[model samples]
Target: MGDVLRRRRPSRAVAPLRRDPRASGRFQRSHRRLDLRQGCVGRRAALLRWALAEMQRAFLGVDCGTQSTKVVLRDPATAAVIAVGRAPHELIERDDGTREQDPAWWIDALRGAVRDAVRGERFDIGGIGVAGQQHGLVCLDRGDRPVRAAKLWNDTTTARECADLTRKLGGDRRVLELTGNLLLPGYTAPKIAWLASHEPEAYARTVRMCLPHDYLNLWLTGEFLTEAGDASGTAYFDVRARRWCEAVLAAIDATRDWTRALPRLAPPLSVVGMLRREAAESLGLEAGIPVSAGGGDNMCAAIGCDLVVEGPAAVSLGTSGTVFAYRAEPAVDPLGEAAAFCDSTGGWLPLAATLNCTSATEWVRELFAMDHAEVDAAMASGGAAGLAFLPYLSGERTPNRPEAAGVFVGVRPSHGRDAIVRAVVEGVTFGLAYALDALRRAGVAPTEVTLIGGGSASDAWAQLCADVFDLPVARPAIVEAAASGAARQAQWAVEQTRPSLAPVTSRRFEPRPRRDLREAADRMAALREMAGANRL
Candidate 1:
């Protein structure tokens, strides 16, 4: 873990520390009183040091993602990334449709990422924020330790529980009215319902239930609190009102008292608490640094891309693909295809998520024993070649088919490996296009699209997204939007002002009209219908 952190160092040196013009006025006014006190030479020196440190402080942002924990250190004023580090954690997958991770692994990964990010650097950290994968259920007992493995968002063992909750709530539409979302197997409420029915002993022992980011926040600040963005994904939260809905909780058999199990709600940009002594010591940082109430990964990514204002939508193509847009008012989809979520900036986020993305491309790359560059070359030359594929390697979410499996249609012997790989890539892009259409149906019309996540690193993939979505796609200079957004939240918490740094677009891909894509779209529609009819 330590080795993971030490592997990457910033290519450029940070600018020398200087007095911040923004803080000079306040510092001068406060210093006048320090000089007037009698026998205060030591106190004056300490105060001066503290004031100077504040002028040159750097902010730390930790992103506890599904595969790894990433840390980024940046200048709050300029938003220039000074250093970065990451550490990977293992994911437990089961044949019985279970996905779980130990909370302890997250803590260890965060420690490594922080240690590596700040190695040989001595800038005072002004504030810290964390963003994590949403919808994960972290259960704690009276001792504040996890009673069982944390259930992740991809875990699908709660299908029966989802059906039961929907029935108890009267129907899917009624559930959507109460919670702004339909009962889904990936949601926290269904997971809790499953736990109560299957593992009654653990449910009885549970004293608290929180998301992954909330657990990390508790370790840092010793306060159990969550903000609107992540809380809205819990399925028990009322998105329109921005609070927990007792009716939704009752539907899951968690009564009014279950609200106590949830963390206190905090404003997204507010400081939840100062870093605790133990956490500071473990990460080699000073105690009392302000920690902001961070948000879910999607919310933070929106911030990282400067999607606080409308007109630009963000499409993240990671293990899962999501299309999200900022909205001034809650945009509830009556059919429940789009999730009505809250943004970290006190706005609404209407998003549609698909279960598969780069995971499909990765599968093809591994099958051919090729590196990314090799795959890119093959895709550039192979084209679609009339081959079609459904990239539902791990089932699906947007179309609501949990039992569906991957399918390859229109394949011929002459198509070979390269053509199949290209088909896989196109299939994933088509899946994202379906999500984009859902957002459009919900009345989100973005002037431009921001493509992000691990897949955005490939120019070929970015072009494919632009061509398929039929919109100009821009990739920001910084690829780690989630961590960058978390840092911006930290800056906002410490300064009491929104960070003014605009995301710099390093490259933009314009949509190109292709006759072949039109035919491919038809094939995709037909294939989707076939899969729906033959769902396993």
Candidate 2:
């Protein structure tokens, strides 16, 4: 891999989307070769026409998220989205700190989304890429069937395993030196440890361990491969070295034979394989189309927002909240709060992630029985004098607390519904602020933050984030940044050249004069102390 990197030329020029004007007309003429009188020939001609049409238009990007699967078709020349489609999936949450999802649903959702996205379109897709939720443990048996439901990043059932893995590896510092990350419950290594001990039968049957995107890649191309950015979150990969850390694997009690279960490492912009015949049929695409080795969602989002430089940073508000910056080289955190990850474009991504963000707001919206517009209205009318809320509903990661729960302090009879709603919104924003502080501690100073995700759609939330973080906040014109990034990555893989994607800001929220949030910050500190004192 190092040799490959040494031989490859670094080009900053974006790949030009290849277009052939006569290809479509020639493809249509080829159908004339088949006799329309025969039924079989007619069917064959139709399939051929579909395949040829797909080769002429744009690249495809699919984002398999925690709550939904989203697909986007983009014009390769301008990096502009042509069409989009989405399908939601249910998350199985248990009372005992368990979050799981069936892998089959992802396949179904992907096909459904692709079908919807390409409806009434006859253009050919150039290449395909996938950006999925990171740190998910997808275990497959020898027959390539899932052993059980995949445990998600937010699942907290592996706390004991995390601690045990750290102890086995000597200590936190040693573990960090080996993998550039501490053994957190959300990482893939600790989840594997938990499975080995808690469900030995399933562990024994497991033949391959893959991240969410890797599983999707396998379904698409019949290959087991992963890229650096997503692999870095596994706690079994060396972030700086860009390979699996054997020491970390040994510490987790994975024998030499078990290490074979890991996926092969591929470069982010390299084509891992061609689309399989069956998968192509299902997706209404060509069977021989190239499939790129895509990265984690955050890494792809960085590409979408054009955060390839050192100063610009981004905040993603989805199922999880993340504050990430680009670096020319690997940037490891001494405290292991900010993740040291590889970028999709062979750079570095230093980021801090929180477990709760828009999910907290979703809970609040359901609790109050208000639509998004009403919630925005409430935020507009409310002030910050009533109470403080802690948005740790699924525990936290940046603060490294796995057992903390959501809490609201200073609630009084005088507090109205608007106040409570505002508290929830403010709490989530504060969580992002804390993540930004973590990034700053790691020596990353961003001039401003580019906000993307579902929460960024709210004007109130954008202004509140700007005020709380004390930085200018800008939203991108592209709504599906991750999917767009995936499409860009696909083009890069096929062309072997990088595209210059400058972020186009739709709106900017400048910071306003605000009172000190020291009181709210202190409340957060006190809660952390309490959680520490009563560590589970």
| Best of the candidates, TM-score | 1
Q: In candidate 2, what residue range of length 10 has the lowest lDDT sum?
A: 8-17
**Which segments of model 1 are wrong by more than 4 Å?**
1-56, 254-256
Residue 166 of model 1 has an lDDT of 87
226-322 in candidate 1: lDDT tens per residue? 9999999999999999999899787777453776888989998899999898887777777888899999999999988889888988999898898
- Which 10 consecutive positions of candidate 1 have the poorest summed lDDT? 8-17
For model 2, state the Cα shift of residue 253 in Å.
Answer: 2.0
lDDT of each: 0.85, 0.85
Winning model by lDDT = 1
